[model samples]
Target: MTKDTRKTEYGNESISSLKGADRVRLRPGVIFGSDGLDGCQHSFFEILSNSIDEAREGHGNVIEVTRFTDHSIMVQDWGRGLPVDYNTKEERYNWELVYCELYAGGKYQNNSGENYEYSLGLNGLGACATQYSSEYFDVTVFRDGYKYRLHFEKGENIGGLSKEKCKYEQTSTIQKWKPDIQVFTDISIPLEYFQTVLKKQAVVNAGLRFILKDEESGETFVYCYENGIVDYIKEITREDGFTEIQFYETSTKGRDREDKPEYKVKMQIAFCFNNHTNLLEYYHNSSFLEYGGAPDKAVKNALVYEIDKCIKNRGKYNKDEAKITFADIEDSLILVVNSFSTVTSYENQTKKSITNRFIQEAMTDFLKQQLEIYFIENKIESDKIVEQILVNKRSRETAEKTRINIKKKLSGSVDISNRVKKFVDCRTKDLLKREIYI
Candidate 1:
């Protein structure tokens, strides 16, 4: 065999090929699903997700985001900071390894109840990829009476992780970086967009303080909620006339894994029908699900099922009109669903969808039970809702009948002599210039 062919056969382009940082640097889209401003904004989310993960794990309660005049962004959190120990094999600080290496994090095996059960940075590429895609990244960690700092430029360590003795008592982490425009099309963080993201995070976290400041304008905004998603729903639907806000929350035991305790799935949902608009927002493990997934479908199913039951129990609809479609129920529906599970399977690296079917079934059953009880207890409100459903059905039927009548009139037998007279009397027969009414 030829030398090149023998080398190819022996796997010459294997482990000795490309490094992780190089791979990530070349393909920023793989980490964020875009290489434009949207992906650059996602890098901020990747870093912010770390802070939220800490809060989710019962660590700190305060997170601060600052936009500097130098076009740089910094995120600071009062959580357990990154470790500063030295790795004997790599001969580098643990914090350095976190940024300089890929697939290295404390989330590999759930840490046997010591670490987070549900988090956004489970893939171990959050901070590393952020660093690899940035022109300059700096991290500071203060833990246990010591302060550590690590700085990097384009994924290369500038001065390495440095440690110093300090009298600090609280553990904290600060990450600041500038996005590489060559790698990303734009990194300008939209203040309003980020405000919405942080607001949603605060609503989910409940009592976790999120402070955002613009250094240039001196404008600051703080977001913190004590009642969680319920408060969020009320605030959003305050202007609209809502019937009632239905809330259902539960924690169910999931199947056990090898040597791990039974996984627990925590879910909370709030939905209401207002007289104004329809909105549905879903989240999993503190990450927003823009495209929606099984859980969303489950909620929709439960809603339709419960409404149909209500209609039947009230004797409002006959056998022919018993069916209630999603469009009918979705009008003026405002819903917020939050779910967390130790074991969750998202569709892709973007984590925009939850692909687990078990979640759907569980959510459907849970909501169905809650709604059944609610309907039984709140008969008056239930009757009013069913009335609205019937009204929607009538309106739809009337519209359909009108449309059919119009179609029949247009398709019915016509007089050819009358048509010919109309066309001939027309001043212009040019389709573009002529106007006709039938």
Candidate 2:
């Protein structure tokens, strides 16, 4: 055996910790989930999420976003500007904790209702991580009758904190940053992303207004929804729905487990059945759940159970017919669920889904009860829903059968009698030696 001198020694000194900006700069994917354009987009959303959280807490009603031709982005919110002064408890500058330290923010004690009742940027890593991954970051906060400013270049603070008396009566926070090319492979987020996200935010935030400005095109777009999801549903269906839209909302408190702390959940649901159009969207804490987890399961379970019961009781199904599935209902149903919880278990930092057991249980139970009441009170609508769902089910079944028949015909064994045009086959039976040419 030969001792290899080329190998590096494994010792205590070899273990090193990433600190400050390096924590996010060195491993951008660990925090933002990507080191490419997606990560840059996530960084933008992080800052936007903070503004959204503040607005949701009733501190603001408007958020402004600007896209510069230089690829820098800015978010301004009329919220209680972030506390960037001093912190007596932590004995550190609030600016340091907010911009320089990860895992530090006011949203951590949400269950206590001290800071935010429901928050989107709950991880506390958004501000610091975004700052660390930016080529240059700037923050301007107006609060406490003073204007506070902080600047960072390449994740390092430039002039610490700049404070001066403010003349404006309204308090606000403005953040501007350019994602660093060094940190991300690409940072050129498109304007369409901003428009879509801002529209979604406006839809979920109800009366809140989002203003987007494109520097390159010199165009400004505004988005606002007075009635939130219900209005959005109407816009999508154009009031051509077969049934009138229904809206239901409720609040509850519970814990995922006996040992877990209890938290509050607020849910709003709007839905209608349309033969020509269909949509289903789920949002949690104002963040769009692209891959809904708890809410999706709850909706599927509750709707299927209730609708199936209604169908069976009304004799809408044919003899020996199977119960309708969610897909059948989905083909003609338009629903939007906006839910917020004091405690959330997001699948990841992206917040595309949630896995809270209590949330699923609560939503499932609440939806079932609402659907039961709705079905009983509106017999005509219930009948129409069942009829439409049945049509969709039968149509899907027919399509499946047709697809299977087509697949069978196409997959039939091709022999000399059924040889396809321009096709050749090998004579050797051995699989290794066989060859088929097109």
Q: Given candidate 1, what's the lDDT at residue 35?
A: 92
Alpha-carbon deviation at 270 in model 1, angstroms:
1.4
In the range 1-438, model 2's lDDT, one tens digit per residue, is: 998779778998899999879999999998888999988998999999999999999998999999999999999999999999999999999999989998999999999999988999998899999999999999999999999999999999998899998788799999999999999999999999999999998999999999999999999999999999999999999967999999999999999999999999999999999988989999999999999999999999999999999999988889899889899999998999999999999999989999999999999999999999999999998988898889899999999999999988887854664566565555777898876554
Q: Which residue ranges in model 1 land beyond 4 Å of their true spot? A: 1-17, 88-92, 256-262, 400-438
Q: Report the number of the highest-lDDT candidate.
A: 2
**255-346 per-residue lDDT for model 1 (tens digits):** 43446555668899998777677789999998899988978899889989998988877788866764878778777678999998877778
Decoy 1 TM-score against native: 0.86
lDDT of 1 at 83: 79
Residue pairs that clash (backbone atoms under 3 angstroms), model 2: none
Candidate 1 local lDDT, residue 109: 67
Model 2, position 171: C-alpha lDDT score: 95
Clash pairs, model 1 backbone: none
Error of 1 at 41 (Å): 1.1
The lDDT per prediction is 0.83, 0.94
